[model samples]
Target: MPTAYRLLLPLGLALLSACAHQPGSLAVHQQSQCPLSLRSGQQVILTLPSNPTTGFRWVLRDGASSLLDSLGPEVYSNPEDAGLIGSAGQSTWRFQARQAGAGHLLLTYQRPWETEVAPAKTFDCPLRVQ
Candidate 1:
């Protein structure tokens, strides 16, 4: 084989090996339906639209801890034009698939202080961890 070809082949294989060990993340939005599948140790982010000024927030109705582990608490971010009043932002939750099993996540957007009213929005995700 040519010396140039030998040198390039080793470099290419090394780069691919490095990438294989890196962790991966998946992002799911409100429009996305449930029954999602993921490999073990992969991370998933659930993002939903929210406007806290109106007293509506996304709360986790149910979390299947046996199949997934919470990376941390949920996070919220506002749009770049934040000066506008009553503008909506994004709320995101991060979780890591821990084992091989089926699980579900339920979330609702509602006012915590109000009990009788129904949620303004909801996210229901059924998950399979492999």
Candidate 2:
């Protein structure tokens, strides 16, 4: 094979792989770890630590984006020994990039019944779809 062809082939494959999701996926907890850009059809997951036993849950304050679509309903999971009682776990939200445009996601941690109280935590992720 030509040297140029070999070089280009690997580079192209790398770029394509970058657009695909990694195996055994998990949500990103830290906002700093969030990707600034993503390719169309790529999915982004945001995970936050939560303890629903206390009545506080992560809610989607603003996740509507023309460039993105919610993949499915939010999911929650608990660690091993789920029967241990009062154990904290995680909540996740997934979104798939639909087209080339800007995207926005906002999440707030609060109790749904407490309207007068402020959220305990918040996550905001802004993204660009390519």
Candidate 3:
């Protein structure tokens, strides 16, 4: 191989590595008609398996009310589902709510290296008393 090609090879490799797919995304479920369950308390309970990624952050909004905030590491290999991240970024609004009432909910997620925010999803629904 040419000496020039050898000298430039490592630089080329570095450039290629920099272009690797960034970590982070928001997904939602289509045709999902499941309801969100809310209980009378300050905590929301739900179950999910770990997603495959670096980390995740979540935000919960009640459309008409101030945001109910919760943030945590998004360990994709473990049970990492942000109740506020929504299913595939799709949300049922009333699921895992800490209050019983009528309200709209939106879930969003983002990671450290993400260039764009996950879809700003909004779900209008009634919080069913569980």
Report how far off residue 116 is in candidate 3 (Å).
Answer: 4.0
Q: Whole-model lDDT for model 2 versus the true structure?
A: 0.80
TM-scores for all predictions: 0.80, 0.74, 0.30
What is candidate 1's lDDT per residue for 1-130, written digit by digit as tens? 9999999999999999998986799888865656789899899998888899899998898877998899999898888878787799999999999999997898989999997999988788889998
The local distance difference test score of each candidate is 0.88, 0.80, 0.39
Winning candidate number (lDDT): 1
* Candidate 2 wrong stretches, greater than 4 Å: 1-27, 81-83
Q: For candidate 1, what is the lDDT?
A: 0.88
Q: Best by TM-score, which number?
A: 1
Candidate 2 structure quality by residue, lDDT tens digits, 28-92: 78888765577777777877888999999988977757887888888989988777688998888
Off by over 4 Å in 1: 1-19, 31-33
| lDDT ranking, best first | 1, 2, 3
How many Å off is the CA of 30 in candidate 2?
1.3
Cα lDDT, model 3, residue 63: 38
RMSD, each candidate, Å? 4.8, 7.3, 18.6
- Which runs of model 3 end up more than 4 angstroms from their true locations? 1-33, 37-43, 49-55, 62-100, 112-115, 120-126
Candidate 1 vs candidate 3, lDDT winner = 1
lDDT of 3 at 127: 35
